[model samples]
Target chain A: MIQVVVNFTERTYNGFMKVKQKLEILADAAKYDASCASSGTEQRNSRNGKGIGSTTGAGICHSYAPDGRCISLLKILLTNFCLFDCVYCVNRVSSNVPRARFSIEEVVQLTLAFYRRNYIEGLFLSSGIIQSPDYTMEQVVEVARILREEHDFRGYIHLKTIPDASPDLLARAGRYADRLSINIELPTAAGLSALAPEKDAGAIRISMAGLRERIDASKDKTASGKCPPRFSPGGQSTQMIVGADASDDRTILTTSADLYGQYRLRRVYYSAFSPIPDASPMLPLQSPPLIREHRLYQADWLMRFYGFEAHEIITSEHGMLALDMDPKTAWAIQNRAMFPVDLNRASKSTLLRVPGLGVRNVQRILTARRVRAVRLDDLVRMHAPVSRMLPFIQLPDYHPGATLDAASLPARLREVPTVPQQLGLFM
Target chain B: MHTVYLEHETDMEGWRYAARQLIRLEVAPQEVSWCVKSAREPGIQGDIFAMPDSRSGSDCSSQEWAISNHAGREVVGISQYHGKTDVTSSTIFPEQLAPSTHADHLMVPRQFIELARSVILHQAPERFYLLYRVLWRLQRERGLMRLAGDADVARLHAMTKSVRRDMHKMKAFVRFREAIVAGQPRYLAWFEPEHHIMAAIAPFFIGRFATMDWTIMSPNMGMNWDGDVLQFLPGGKLEALPAEDDSEVLWLSYYRHIFNPARLKLKAMQKEMPKKYWHNLPEAELIDSMIAEAGTRTQAMLQRAPELPRRKIIGYKRGPQRPDITGGNE
Candidate 1:
C-alpha cells in the first residue's frame, strides 16, 4: 500500500481542507500530457440548462511552442505520488519530488475556481498510481462525476486512463470526460515493460481497444438521434514518451502509425523524456534533444495534416527526423527526382507534401484550382509562402527546377537555427 | 443560413458555397468566430441557423430561393462564425467592416440600405456583405419609407469605399524610425490619403508606436512630430515619398533583426505585406532580391544581405525636419 504525507489520519478526509495544495501538485503532474489541443470543438455552456461553462476554443492557446503548436488545455496531473515506480517519472514513489493529493471535492473546487477565473477553458487531469490502480481511478472518476452531475461543469474534461482499472469505473469516467487518454509508454510492449516494470502493456491495449469500441458505439447512437449515452464526446487520445526507451524514430513513428490505424484516436502526443531523479541505470542520463520532440511533431503533422506515411519517413541512421530540417523537407531533398511538381495539377495529397502548404492552404488551392487554372501569382494571392514553396512547386508562371541544382539546395534551405524557447517573451 | 441549417446535411453543399462567397465579400468584421466544430457527424452538430454562420436576418430564401429544389438550405446574409443570437455572434468580418448589432432579430432598414446599394451600384461581392448588412438594418429599424434616399445610400457607399482605400494605404505607407533623438528612438513615416483623413487613423499609429517620437509625412498635407507641435504638410508635390534615402537601409536592418527564419511562413507574411509594395521602399529591393533567390538563400536570411555599416552619430536629416528649438528654452 502507498502512503500519504503529513498524516491525513489526524486531519480527516474532507477534501476542501487541502484544496490549495491540490491545485499545485495536480497542475504540475498534468503538464506532461500532450493532448490538450482545443482546435476542434464547438460545444457551449447551456447557461440555462444544467451547466456552468463552455468549450469553444480560442487564442494562441499557450501552444504554438517554438515549433508553432498550441498548448490548448489546462493541462495538469492529479497527484504525483505512486506505488508503481515508472522509471521515467520525476515523481515516481522512489523519486524525491514533493508530493500532494486532493480529495475528489478538492479537485472539483480547484477546477471550478480556475474555470470561473477564466484561467483555462477546461481541465486535463492525470495521476500517479497511489495505493492501487482502483484507488487512484476512484478519485479521478469522482472529480469528473461531481463536475458533470453536481456542479454541472459542461466544459471540456480530459481524464487520464488507468489501464488496469475496472470497466465499471472506466465506463463512468467516459460519461463525463470530453476525452480520455492512456500513455502507451513507448512504441512496443517490450519497451513498455523494460521502462515501466509494473505496467501491463497488454492491459493498456485492452483498455484502448475497449474505449474505441465504446466511442464508436456512442457515436452511432448519437448520429441516429438516440442519445443512448454520451461516451467520450471528444473521443480518445494517447501519448508516447519518446527517447525514454531505446526506440528509434522509425520504431516510434511506426508505433504511432499503428495506433492511429487501430484505436481511431483523436491524437497521440509525443513527450520527449524528462530525466527522472534517482534514475534507473538502464535509462540515459540526459533528456533527449528538444529538437527531436519538434521533429516528431512535424512528422506527426505530416501523417495527420500533410499525408506522409511511415515507410516514407523511416530512414537509416537518422531513423526518424533530421534535427535541423523538417521531415518533409529532408524527404524532398532525398527524393530530388520528384521536384517541380505542377501545383495546378498535383493531387490534394501531393500538394500537402510540399513544405509550405498546410491543410487549409491545400483546401484553398483545390477551391481556387476548380475556378481557374492557378498561376504563381495565385499562390501568392492565397498567401502560400512562395519562398520555401517556390523551388518545390511548379506554377504556370514560374519554374525553379532549371535554376536550383542539387549541390546548393541545402544552402538555399539553410537559416541560422533559432531555438523556439527564446521567442516566448514577445508573446 | 437558417434554411441551410434546416436542410438535411447532404443537400446543403450549395448553401455552404454561397456562405463562403458572402463571407469573403465583407471588408470588415475582421474574423467571424465560426463554430468550426460540431458535436455531430460530418462535424456539424448544432442547430444550423444558430451555428454562427452569418448575420441574423429574415431567411432570404423564404422570398428568394422559394423555387429551389430543397426548401431548406438558403442561408444568406447571416453571421455564421458567431452564434444564433446577436449577443454571442462573432461577426466574420473585422469590426471596421461588420459592426455589431442586435443579433437575434432582423433590423430591416439596414437590409434595405444594403439591397439599395447592390441594385443601384452592382457592388462587387467583396464589399456587398457589409453594405447589405448596413442597409438591411436601416430598412428594418429606421423604416423603409424613410431611407436617406438614393443619394444618401450612394454617399454612404462612397464613404465606405474611401475607408477601404485609406486602410490599404495605412498598411503600406506607415513607416517607423530607429534613430534615437536624445535618449528616445525617433521614428516617422509618410502618407498621402486621397481623402485626407490622417487625423482619423492617427490613434492606430499612436497606439502601435506608444513609445516613439514619430512623425507621419504626407504630401500636400503635412503631419509633423514634437509634442507641442501638430504641423501639416505645407503642400508639396502630389508624388509623395517617391525618392530613395539612406534611412531605408537602417529600417530594413531593424526588420531583418526581428524576422525569425525558424518560423518563416512566407504566405502569411506576404498576405500582410505583398510584393507589389516593395518598389517604393529601399528595403523592398533587398527583400525582393532575397525572396526571388528564395531557393538558394533560405539558409542565411539576414547575413546574406549586406548590412549598413554602424554609423557613429545619429542621422536627423531626410530633407530636414523642423529641428527642436529646445536650446532657447533652456
Candidate 2:
C-alpha cells in the first residue's frame, strides 16, 4: 500500500487554512487534463450590473504557458482525492501525491478574483472521482450553482461530467456550464479495461447520448413557442490520452471520429501521455510522444474541417502518421496524381485539400479572384507559405514543372531543417 | 492645391463635409490635400478650412463657390461665415448635376464606409487623402473597391489590417492590475497601441468588463469605466501605472506551474505571445528561466527509472474488485 506523508506546512490566510497549499495541489492535479480551451461559448456580458463577468463567443487566451499551452481558463480540480486508481492519472488513489480540496466558497472566490484582475476568461472546474459517483457529482454541481445563481457570474464555466452520475445532476450541470466534458480516458475499451479498470466504456457512451439529447432538445423551441433553458451552448468536448496503449494513430482517430459523429462533440483533445512522479510499473518510462500527439491533432483537424475521413489520413502501412512531416503534406505526397491543383479554377474543397493552402488563404484567393486573376504576387502579399504550396498548386506565373513527378519530391516537400537538431534533442 | 484642414485628429464629420463640397465642385482628387488642424494650431473653428468662409450650419455651396474660384489658394474659414455658404451655388455644372447629388450621387459603397472607419483610426498622414482619393474614383468606377489587386484599394486594405491588428493586440495585451479607490476595488491596465484606435476599440473593453470599474490607458488616449458609466481621458504615460500589484503574484504562480517543461515549442509560443509584449506581462519574466531549465528537467524525467506502483490507500467497495491479472485493479 502506498503511504502518503502529509507534508503540507499548513498555512493560514484570514482564518482560512491551507488556501495556498490547496491551490498548489489542486492545480498540479488538474495539469494532466489537456482541455484548456474556453472558446465557442455563448456570448454574454455583465452590462446590466447584475453579473460580475463576461464570456466572448470566441474565448481569449489570457496567457501562454512555456509548454505553448494556452492559459485561458482557471483549470483546477475540486480536489485531488480519488477512488479509482487509474494508472495514467496523477491523482489516482494508488498514487502518493499530496491531496487537498477546495471548499465551494474558495473556488467561487478564486474565479471571481482571477476574473476581476483580467487574468482569465472564466473557470474550468474538474475533479477526481470521490465518495459515491452521485455524491461526488452533487458537490461539483453545487460549485457551479453557487457561481451562477448566488453570484450571477456570467462567465465561461466548463465542468467535467462524471459518466456514472444521474441524469438530473447532468442536466443541472448543463444548465450552469457553458461547456461540459466527459473524458473517454483511453481510445479503446480494451485500453480502458487494462489501464483505468474502474471506468466503464459503455456507461460513458450512454451518458454522452443522454447529454446530446438534452443539448439538442434545448436548442429548439417548444410547442407553445417558449424557449427552453440554455444547456451547454458551448457544447460538449472530450479528451483521449494519446500513446498510452497499443492503440495506433488510426485507431485513435477512428475513436475521435466516432465520438464526433455520435455525440456531436465540439472538440476531442489529444493529450500526449507525459511521465509522472510515482509512476506505475506497467506504463512506459520513456519520454512522452509529443510529436505523435501533434500529428494526431493535425490529422483530427483534417477530419473535422478538411473533409478528410479517418481512413484517408492514416493510409500509411503502419497505421501511423509521419512524425517528420505534417499529415497534409504526407497525404499529398502519397497521392501524387492529385497534385497541381489550379489555384484559380479549383473548387473550395479541392483548394482546401492542397498541401499548404490554409482555409484563410484559400478564402482570400476566392475573394481576390472575383475582381482579378490571382497571381503569384497576390499570394505572396496574402502571406501564404508559397514555397510549401508551390509544389502542389499552379498559378498563372508559376508551375511545378517536373517537380511533382520527381522521385525526390517527398524529400523536397519535407520541412527544411530551419532550426538545428541539437535543440530538438533537448525538446 | 486646396488644403482642406479638418478640425481634429479623428474628425470624420469634418472629412465628410469637406469631401461632399469638393466632390460637388468637380474638383479632381489630385488638386486637393486634406489636413487636420493640429492641437497646437487652434486658430480657426467649425472644421477650419473645410468651408473656407466658415459656414457652420448645414449648407456649404457659397463657400464651395469661394473654393472653386480661389482654387490653388489658401482658404481660411473661421466661425465668421455661419449660414452664409449656399448648398446649390458651388457646383461646376449646377443644373446638369442631379438634385440628389449631395445625398446620393457621391455615395460610396457600405464596404468603403466600414473600411474608412478603420482607415481613419490609422496614424498615417495620408489616410484622409487616400480615403478621399478612393471616394473620388469610386464615383466613376462603381466596382473599384472590389478589386483588392488595385494599388489604392490594396493600400486601404493594408491600413485597415494594421488598424485591426492594433485593436486585436489592445484587446489581448491589456493586463489589469487591481487597485482600490474609495474603498472599492478598481482595475487598471496599460497598453501601447500603434494607431489612433483608443476610441475605436473602447467599446469592446466596455462590453467585456462591464461590472468592474476599470481603466485601459494607452499613449494616445485612456478609457475609463465605473460599472455604469464609460468615459474617455486624455493620453497617458507608462509611468502613470504602478509597476506591480498583489494579484499578479498569484497570476505569475499559475503561469509558472501551468507550463510543462517537456514540450517547449518556443517558436510557436513566441509567435502568438511575442517578445514585444514581454515587458508588460508579469508571467513573461519566467519564460527565459523556464526555457533554460527545461533541458535539465526533461533529462531528469527521461533518465529516472520508473518507480514501483503504489498500493491503493482507499478503495470503493461497490465498484468492481481486482480481476485475475498481474497488475489490473477493478
Off by over 4 Å in 2: A1-17, A222-224, A416-427, B24-29, B38-103, B308-312, B317-330
Model 2 DockQ, alpha carbons vs. true complex:
0.28
Tens digits of per-residue lDDT for model 2, A94-166 = 7777888999898988888888777888899999888877888888899999989998888889999988877
Q: Cα deviation of A2 in candidate 1 (Å)?
A: 35
TM per candidate comes to: 0.55, 0.86
Candidate 1 chain A has its poorest 10 consecutive residues by lDDT at A59-68
Of candidate 2 chain A, the 10-residue stretch with the lowest lDDT total is A1-10
- DockQ for all models, in order? 0.02, 0.28
* Candidate 2: pairs in clash: B61-B86, B62-B86
Top candidate when judged by TM-score against the true structure: 2
**Highest lDDT, which number?**
2
Each candidate's interface RMSD (Å, one decimal) is 26.6, 7.7
Off by over 4 Å in 1: A1-18, A39-42, A57-72, A222-225, A276-282, A316-318, A415-427, B1-330
Query: Please, what are the lDDT tens digits per residue for candidate 1 over residues B1-330?
Result: 222231221122332333333434331222221122111112122453244344333322222211112223233344542444453332332221333443433344444434343232221222323343343334234432232223334345455555655554453345443344688645555545544345445544433233335566655344555543444444345244333323333233323322222233455445444454444344444554444544443344222332222323222111222122111222
